[model samples]
Target: MAAIELRNIVKVFSDKRRGRDLLTLDNINLDIEANDFVCLLGPSGCGKSTLLNIIAGFEQATSGRTLVGGKQVERPGSDRGVVFQQPTLMPWLTAIDNIAFHLKLKGVGKAERHHRAMEFIDLVGLRGFEHHHPSEMSGGMNQRVGIARALLMNPSVILMDEPFAALDAQTKLEMQEELVAIWQKRRCTIVFVTHSVDEALVLGNKIVVMTKRPGRIREAVNFDLPRPRDITSPEFNDAKRHILALIREESTRLAQAS
Candidate 1:
């Protein structure tokens, strides 16, 4: 069975002021296999994040179904972890404590929580700064803390909505490398949403492109480029070219329609 399934999903928003409903997603169907690193690639306002939210059980689809591990997703659950564009860490909590906060809520003893959280701290390469609060850490470091917090739950899938969009170019590249390493080591299914073709190519084994709103799957491109991918290689450029063409085509069509 697929790790995550979106069956004929559709989403609409009530535009109260406009006195109409705006369709954001239309007849989307996708199956993400276990351990597949899937990137949802699309332009801004294309509803990639909405689709992700549906999979994460944070939002309900207007119609159709989302299943994770063969079970219908009714609401947010521990089986899926989500990291947003912002780190959203607690300002007062230290890195380790923030990562272990969920465990603490479940009444886990302090020592056990610390022990468990430490593993993820090391995994995200925040070992030395584990005691620092969010306010003290750099944006990249805080993002790592958020990632560690999600992983400490040991969720089967991770849903990320452009988590590196806020980082500086250098930090973004470093985080991308670290994220790929973590994904390889953890072997968990990840559905990442990003607008950047380069970021998608760098991180995903499969890239699912989406059209302009109302968003629909344009194509699912299999990218088998070896890890530590050579962005300058012919193969990488070819894939990027294909994806860019698709996006450009979509944009042209939308412009014509408008």
Candidate 2:
């Protein structure tokens, strides 16, 4: 069975000011295999983030079902970990403390919590900066802390909503490389949402392209490109060309409708 399943899902939002209901997602279905890195890629208005939110149990679908690890996802649970666009770390706590806060909530002792979090701190390359607070760290560093926090949960699935979207180009590339390495080592299912084609191609083995508002799955392209992918290779360029064509077609269709 698939590690994650979205069966005929639909999401609608009531636009109070417009006095109408907006259908954001329509009859979407997807199956993600274990340890697969899937990227939900689309334009800004696409429901990619909404889909991630549904999987995270942060939003309810208007219809259909969501199952993760053979269980219905009715609410948020420790079985799934999430990393949002922003770090959202606690200002007062140090990086290590923030990473192990979940353990603290479950009554773990400070010594044990720190010890456990230390592994993830090293995993994310924040070894020497473990004691730094959010304010003391750069955006990328805080994001690493957020990722470590999520990893420490040992969840079956990790949901990321453009976690590196706000970083500088160089920082973003570094984080992407590190994320792919961590995903490979950890061997956990990851569903990442992003608007960047390059970002999606870089990180995901399976790229699920989504259409604009009233979102539908355009295609789920299986990349299977070798790890430490050569972005400049002909194969990579070919894949990029195909994806760009799909996006252009979608944009043209939308233009005609308007």
Candidate 3:
């Protein structure tokens, strides 16, 4: 059985001022197998983030079903970890404290929480900075803390919505490499939402392209290129070209329709 399943999922929102309902997702069907790294790639406003939110249980689909580990997803649970675009770490809490905050809420003793959180802190390469507050860290470092916090939960799936979008080019590249390494080590299912074709290509073994507003899956492209992918190679460029063509084709179709 697939690790995650989406069967004819649809989402719509009320546009109160406009006196009409806006459809954001239209029948998004997908099956993500265990340990699959899937990237949802699309243009802006394509509902990629919305789809991610639905899977994270932050939003309910207007219709159809979302299942994870053979169970329906009704609300946010610890079985799924989510990392947003912003690190969203507490400004006052030190890195280690923030990462272990969930454990604290569960009434775990400080020593035990520290022990468990330290494992994730090391996993995310934040050993030396564990005592620093979010304000004391760089954007990349704070994001690392956020990732550690999520992983500390030891969830079966990780859902990320453009978590690296805010970093500088070099920092973003470094984080990407670290994330790929972490994912390889953990071997967990991940559904990452991003608008960048290159980012998707670099991180995902499976890429699902979505159409413009009222999003639908255009195609699910299997990318089996080896790890530490060469972005300039023929295979990489070929995949990029194909993905771009799909986006362009969708754009042109929408333009013509309008």
Candidate 4:
């Protein structure tokens, strides 16, 4: 059974200044399988993030339906965890506390919170810095905290909106590797939104490419390239070329229409 199902999902934003309704997404339908690493990839303004938000229940669809775990999503819940581009952590709290904050909010005991958070801290390779505050950590470290926090929820689905977009190239690469490792080990469904073609290729087993504004799925490419993917391999380059062509064609089509 599919972990997430989007049936004819559409999103429209009111453009008060323009006195019109701008269609952001148009009839998006997709089924993400359980334990799938699916990347919603497209150019900027393609509404990939909006689609992810709808799935996460942060935003409602203007029309159609979104289902997670065979149930309709009406509001955000613990079944889904979201990681934004920024590490939205509590600056005053220590790493372990930040990670266990959600449990604390639910009235979990302090001993249990630390015990559970410690597992994720170790999972994200932050075992030594559990007491460090956000101010004392680097961007990569804080992002790790964000990821660990989300993971601690043990959600059925994880939604990430360009979580590594702000990191340095080296740090981004490291985080990507760590994330893939975590996903492999945990076997949870993940829907990640990214504008970078290479980032999608590196992180997703299934790449759902979206079109320009009034977004539609251009194609859903299934890439089973082996882990520790060689970026320069012939198979990798071949796949990249195909995806680039699809995006280029979309751009050209839009240009001609304009």
TM-score against native, each model: 0.99, 0.99, 0.99, 0.99
The TM-score obtained by model 3 is: 0.99
Write one digit per residue (lDDT tens) for candidate 2, span 107-143. Answer: 9999999999999999999999999999999999999
Q: Candidate 1 — which pairs collide?
A: none
In TM-score terms, candidate 2 sits at: 0.99
Candidate 1 residues 84-132, lDDT tens each?
9998888989999999999999999999999999999999998889999
lDDT of 1: 0.96
Assess each prediction's global lDDT (C-alpha) against the native.
0.96, 0.96, 0.95, 0.95
Off by over 4 Å in 1: none
The residue pairs in collision within model 3 are none
- Candidate 4 matches the true fold with a TM-score of 0.99
Identify the runs in model 2 with alpha carbons over 4 angstroms from their true place: none
- In candidate 1, position 51 carries an lDDT of 97
Off by over 4 Å in 3: none
lDDT tens readout by residue for model 4, 57-157: 98999999999999999999999999999989989899999999999999999999999999999999998999999999999999999999999999999
